[model samples]
Each structure stands twice: as structure tokens, then as C-alpha cells.
Target: MRDAEISSWRQWVTGLMVAGLVIGTAGGPLVGQETDDAEEGPQQVIIERTPVQLRDPKTYSVSLSLEPIREIDLVAVADGVTGAVQVQLGGAASRQAEAVRLDSAERQLELERAKALFRVAQAEQRATSGGDANAVEAAEGRLEAARAELRLAEHRLDATVVRFPFDGKVMGVHVVPGQFVRAGQPLVTLADTSKMRVAIPVDRTAVNEGDTVDIKIETDTVQAKVETIVPLKAEFEPLRELFVSVATAVLVLENGDGKLKAGQTVFADMIPRQPVMEVPTSTLANMEEGGRKVQVIRDGFVRDIPVKLLGQVGEEHVFVSGRFSAADELVLSSSEVLLDGARAVPAGAEIPTEEDEGAGPAGRRRGSRF
Candidate 1:
């Protein structure tokens, strides 16, 4: 009986061992199946994207003060009493037009006297043509003296009238009729308003001389060209040392309509010198290391592209530079964390077409999942 029991116990132990082996083999496949399920699919994120291109340089609106291209105070050339003021304040004057005239009765009489003396000297020189050599030389000298006196008298008479140097508007009249005025005294203030100038402080790298740009004055928009760029004075050396890009640029604009005025405020559009890309301001993300970044879709996966934040274009858009292609699909926004190489899709139900992507910023449509 003991032998039979011992034999049965051994058989029972053998069966238990076989059952354990079977259970272990089945569990091994289950664990591998769990791992396969976990690794089967990539995380999906909802994203909005737009196609990017090397767009035109970004424009910045800078405030500027309009001033006349030329301004001058017409001064009296000769000392005299005011005879007449031909131009009124705010009146237009043509080039070389008489703007003021000083009293010249005495000068006119002097000119007539000099002319009579010159004529008498001419007659005397002719009468002495065949006379003694000493007498003829004396007559010739008298004729030359009288001629020079006549010229001087004519010049004095001409100096009595103040003429407009150019086509301009009389901004001020400092002399009145019958008012005693002295030489080198201001008689009129004239300004040429046919063209306007604006001296604006700008970034040295952004603007250059002779570049055409747009300017906005109230509701009117006009084109202007950069005339010159002046560096900051030595007193601003500290500013320059701190900010090397500071500079002053002078812009010239046509104002034939006289819409722009001196001391009037206007706006100038300044363009960046470097090529840049346009993206929504919300698309920029800060990097853990430093600087900023934007995401792009490549090969159905999300990838982070390092970008330099140039500046904002407007309220909604910003300009950035990066090693990117015109064909790149810039991810506008993402609902989930976009890890490098992670699979992504559009947030909406339908994927955008190539033509839709080219439709510009307004045509970009957001989808449900990416």
C-alpha cells in the first residue's frame, strides 16, 4: 500500500509541474501582448497649421514729425523805410516774386543823376577824341568813373525789393508799410511746402539712404524716400554703446497739395533689412534652453524648428527668421504638447489642400485633431 501511495504522490507532483509550465507559457504571451498594444499607436494632438513662405520684410510704424524741406527768413539787404508789403501772411509766392519793397524815392533820384552824369561824360569823351593826349586821358577816366557810379546806383535801387527765393508760402510778415527797417532785418518768413521732410530716429540696420517707404498722415497715405542717415552725436555715446543700432534717418515726401505741415505728426513704415517669415504671434513657444521656437509638420510628425523672434508685425502677426522652407507647414497652435517626431494631424475633420494652404493667413482653417 505504501509503495502505491508513494507512486501516486509522484504522479501528482508531475501533473502540478506540467500545469505550472502551461500557465507560465500562457502568461508570457499575455505580457508581450500588453507591450505590443502599448507601443502600437502614437499620441495624437490637435493642431492648427498654415503654410509658410519667405515673405516680404516686416514693416514697423514709426512716429515722425513733418517739417518743411526749406525754410528761410527773407531779410532786408539795404537800410530804408518800408514802402509796401506785397505778400500777406499765409499767402503763396512764386519764385522771384516781389514780396517786399522798401522806400526808394531817394535812390531813384540818385540813379537818374548818375545816368545824366554818365551821358555828359560820354559827350565830353567824344568831344576830346582829337584833343591833347592828357585831356583825352582825363575824359576817359571821367567816363569810366561815371559808368561805375551808374552801376552802383542801379544796384542800390534793385536792393530795395525783396523777392521770393523759391515757390513758397509766406509764413510771416515782419515789416509793414512806412515802417523804418534796417539792413539784415527779417522782412518775411517763407517756407517751401511743395515737399516735406521728417527726421526720424530708427534702427541703423533697418533703414538706408534712398529707400522708398510709405508714410501715413491722418487718412492720407504717401510714399517717401530716405534722404540721409545721421549718426547719433557724441553726447549720445552711452546710448550708442548700449544700443549699437540707434540712428537718425531723414525722409523726404512730396506735399504739393500742402497737406503736410511743419511740426505735424505723421507715421512712417520702416522695413526690416533681413528676409523673414510671417506667423501668428500665438505660434511662438519658448524653449527650455533659451530663445524661442516654432513647430513645423514634416513626414506626418511634429518637429521643432529654432527661430529668432524679430518683432511683431501687427496685433496678431509676428516676424521670425529660421532655417525653414517656403513649403513648410507652420503649426499655428497645438492642443497638446508637441514632442519631436510625434505623430500629428489637423484639428478639424478634413485635411487642408495645398491650394487652401496658399490662400494666405485668412484662409487657414483649424481642425479637431492632429
Candidate 2:
């Protein structure tokens, strides 16, 4: 019985194989032809493209604090008690204006005595004009000594008043009326606010002196010019490690209206020094080895073009430089995998409107057949 069962199973399998061969001979060619047709047909990808545009270099923003163009601490030149305070804290001090006056009664008396002694010396020198040569020489020496003493007295008297060296704002006052202050002690802190200074960190290759930039403070925006550039020191080695050519840019902004103040937060927009090409940020792709690339339609086929990313213009756009030209059409979006040299059809070739450009990543999607 087992032999019979095995023999029957063999016969059934042989019959099924013969039947399958017959069907394949009649219908398999149709299925194979359909697959061959599909393989030979041109791939249909719903790709979105835009013409590459030449745009101004991207602007990089950096936060900074405003500082006075010039600041100094006015110190006491002589030991004296503050007799009067002419300028109050936060008040404007004019050039050559007296800011403080020390008690000068003693200084006044010393000045008077020096004047009297000078007059006496002059009279004695005149008297000795016809005397012996030795007596005349001694009188002349005495007159010279008196003149020197008078000049010293005058200088000491002048030291009693603290005068503003330049037009500025008094930021601090350390001495009040009747307060005794020693020589070299700080009396007032003054800052020249007619122009504001700010130090901005940026890529040295992208920024240069004399370049004008926009600075934002609170809600207001003002223009500032790059005054100088300073290389980073060893202390900024970490920053240098991150950005090899990192440096500080000194910028100056006019504040004649006194609207800008020191220590206020400011945002400086640093524009790139070189011109660059602009494209949508979503179009950038990463290579397996390294670096970035963008797809462009060339000869009706997808071509990969390597680009150097200079900076970002906005959330959706980027500045780049490479071998591509403004006439090239950049692949903004594609529904299928874009392989190098793969034939593709751009379904939307018209330039995207501003509203469409801002429609987020979803707007890049479209129905496609591959």
C-alpha cells in the first residue's frame, strides 16, 4: 500500500508540472513583454524645478553689546575735598566744562604768595643791574627761581577743578560735596556716546573693513560700518577649532541722537564679501563620502552638481557657490530617488511664487509614477 501511495503522488506531481508548462507557453510571453515594456519606458517623476538665480551674498547675524567709542575714568590729580559737583550722574558734560571743584582757599593763598615773591624778585634784579657782576648773577638766579615757583603755584591752583576733557556723558560720580578724595582716585566716569562701537565675531573671509551692515537694536535697525578686524587669540582656540578663520570685527554706528546706549544688546548682520548663487535649502543633498550637492536637469537627465555652502539667506534659502550657472534648472523637489544620470521629467518647471516657496516641506510633494 505504501508503494502504491508513493507512485500515485508522483503521477499527480508530474501531471501538474506538465499542465504548468502548457499554460506558461501560452501566457508567460504576455507578462514578460509587459515587464520589458516597463523597463524600457522613460521614468516619470513629479519633479519641481526652478532656475538658479544670482543673488546677493547671504547675511549672517551675530549678537553683540554696544560700547562707547571712547570711555575713561576722570581721576583726581591732587588730594582735596570736593567743594562742588557741577555735573550730575547720567548728565551730559560739555567739552572744557568744569565738572567738579575742590576747596581751593589754601591753593589761592599759595598762588598769591608766589605772585608777591615774583614781583619782589623782579624789583631786586632791577636794583642789582648796576651792581658787581657776582651780585647781578645771584639776583638773576633768584628771579628765575621765583618764576618757576609761580608756574608751579598756578598749576596747583588749576588742579583744584575737574574739567571735562571732551563732550561726553557722565556715567558715574564717585565723589560728592565735602568728600575727601586722594590723588589718582576716580572722580567721574565719562563716555563718548556720539558714536557707538560693537565687536562682532564672524568668519574673517566673509567680512572686511569698510563694509556697511545693518544692526538691529530692540525693534529699530541702524547701519554700521566695519571699522577693523582682529584675529582670534589663543584664548579663543575653541572657537577657532570650530571655525578655523574666526575673528572679531569692530563696527561703528552713529548715535548722534543718543538713542543708542552702551551695554545694550545689538544684532549685527554681516554680509559676505563675495558674490554667490542662491537656491532653496531643501534642494541640498549629502554625499556618502562628504560635502553637499544639488541636483540639476541637464540634457533631460538628473546631474549632481557639488556646491560650497557659503551661508544661509533665510529659513528656506541658502547661498552657494559652484560650477553651476544661472541658466541651469535646479531640482527643487522630486518624488522618486534622483540618481545621477537618471532620466527625469520636471512636472513643475515654472518658478515657484513667493507664497508657494513658503508653503513648508509639504508643498514639495506631488503625485508621481516610476
Candidate 3:
């Protein structure tokens, strides 16, 4: 019975195979036509390539705006003083102040005469045995009045000539030559150009004190130091006028040649000296249990590298600093099923060089690895 069963099963399998062959032969033309149609159809996939940028460690820089280290508005201290404008409209404040030395010689002489008269009155009183106290009192009153008049005269002299308080440039002169300026009236607007500074937003977390900054003003290159980090307060209240949403910091730069002027817009670069690695954000895989990671091709094998996202260049790329090699071929685009440690074949024409990476602003992207 077991032998019969085996023979019967073999016969059934042979019959099925024969029937399949017959049907396949009968539909041979139809199968060939279907294959031809498939070949003519739009089945070819066109995959565009984006090179993986193997960015080495480099100095990171931040954009900044140039401003004067110090600015002031000169005003009249005393009333009805003729404005001579000792400084030219666009001249240095330090040089202009030197020319406006106030004449206090007459006031000094008046003060000396008052002292002599007061001494004579005291001598007379002593000779008369403290009698005629009225004379002594009168003389004291006169002396006090003379002193007051001398002070007034000094103030008047100061008011007559506009003195430059610092080394700066005259931005504007509200008073004309021979113009009578009233008390508290604005005389001139001055700004110290010997050094320049910028108020950066407080959100710049990378910026710290002692960082060297580079800037360009027309044809001149200016180098400056991060003198201090000024916080929001009464003194820096003016910062609110420019950046109201975020807190700000003051970055100072030396402009000894006076190449930089207040109100002139210039670009400043705060390049850090530390070593860092920058990678494209698109190459990053996803946030897993471990951390943010990116897929790189090494020795024709896939690798998932952990990366610390530092910042974004723009919308398409990110600035990442991590343990990465400059020669690493990053997988910019890959299939959805490509897994870490799996084999991969790069489809890009060439990897991005350092020069190509510097062409545009950096950016970022978000997605999971395929």
C-alpha cells in the first residue's frame, strides 16, 4: 500500500507539470507582447544626485553690524551764546576741542581783587577792636558776590565756545556760525570713530568675550576684539530701538584710521578659532534612542554616525560638529530600505569640495533614514 501511494503521488505531480507547460506554450505570443509593452512604457527611474559634502573642521563666523563705540549730542550750557562751531561739520572732535579753549583770565583777575578787598576790610575791623561789625559784614558780602560773578563769567566763557568732549566725528551741527544758542539747545552731534562696535542680539549663544572679529569697510579691513558682553539695562536702552524682540550685546572694534564711520553699514565676521566639523543636515537620519545621527558610506558599507547639531545654515543645510572625517563620503540620498551597516553604492557624480560648500549659505533638512 505504501508503494502504491508513492507511485500515485508521482503521477499527479507529473500531470500538473505537463499541463502547465501546455498552457504556457499556448500563451507564448501574449506573454511576449506584454513584455514588449512593459519595456516601451515609462518604467525607467531617473534619480538625480547630490554630492555628500565632507566638510572639515573650520572656524565658525557670525554676521554683525558696525556702530560707533561712543556717541554724544552737544548742547548749550548757558543761554544766548554765539555758536562759533570750533569743529568743522565732518572733522575730528578731538582736534576741534583744542581750538575752543575758554578765556578765563579776566575771571581770575576779578577773583584776586575780591580777595584783596576782603583782607583790607578784615584788617580795619581788627584795628578798631571788633567795633563797626557792619563794615566787616559788608566786605564779606562783596567778596562772596565777586566770587559768584567770577564763576558766572567762567560758565559764560564755556558757553561761548563749543568744546569737543572726546575723539569723534561731527555728525551734524545744529548751530551755525554766529548763531545765538539758547540754554539747553542742541549744538552738535558727535560720534567717536576711533573705535567701532556692534550690538548683537542676545540669542547669539556662541559669542563670548575675547573673540576676535573681522570686518570690511569699503576698501579697508578692520579687526576688533570682543571687549565686553553688555546686557540689557539703562545704559544699553538704545539697543531696544534696533532689536526689540531679543536681548543684545555690545561688540567693540578699533578704528584708529577712522576708516569706519557711524551709521555706515558694514559686515562683520566673528570667526571662532576652535576646531569643528560641518555636515549637511539632509544626511542626518533621525532622532533615535541614542541621539541624532547621519548615514555615511565607508568601505562600501553604511554607517550611522552620531552628531551634535550646532546650528542651521539656512533652510537646506545644518552646521554640525562631531567626530567625522574630512574624506567621509556622506550619503545624500538613498533608498528607504537602506539600513545602518548594510552595503551601499553611491549614485552621485562627485563629492562636494570645500570650495563648492562655501558657495552659498548653510541650511537644514528633516527626515528619517530609509
Alpha carbon lDDT of residue 242, candidate 2? 27
**Estimated TM-score for each candidate:** 0.55, 0.58, 0.47
> What is the C-alpha local distance difference test score of each model?
0.69, 0.70, 0.52
Clashing pairs in 2: none
lDDT of 3 at 353: 30
| Model 2 lDDT at residue 320 | 69
Index of the highest-TM-score prediction: 2
What is the C-alpha lDDT profile of model 3 across 144-182, one tens digit per residue? 665666566555554556677777787877766556656
Stretch of 10 with least lDDT, candidate 3: 21-30
- Estimate, for each residue in 1-370, the C-alpha lDDT of model 1 and write its tens digit: 1459647744754543333210001112211124455543233344555556675433332345787899999998878999889999988899999999999998999999999999999999999999999999999999999999999999999989889989998888998899998899999999999998977556688778999877677677778889999985443333232233767778898887777787787753332333467677788889888988888875444568777765455566666777676667777655455555443443333433446557554223222122
Q: Is candidate 1 or 3 superior in TM-score?
A: 1
Report the C-alpha lDDT of model 2 over 1-370, residue by residue, as the tens digit: 1459647744754553333210001112211234455453233345556555555333332346899999999888888899998989999999989988999999999999999999999999999999999999999999999999999999999999889999999999988899999999999999999999987766788789999877677678888899998976443343332243677778899999998989898753332333356676888999777999888765444578877775555466666666665576677665556666444333334323327546444222221111
* Candidate 1 vs. true structure, TM-score: 0.55
- Runs of candidate 3 with Cα error greater than 4 angstroms are 1-43, 46-65, 81-83, 95-130, 202-205, 215-222, 231-247, 268-280, 283-370
The Cα RMSD in angstroms, rounded to one decimal, for candidate 1 relative to the true structure is 20.7
lDDT, candidate 1, equals: 0.69
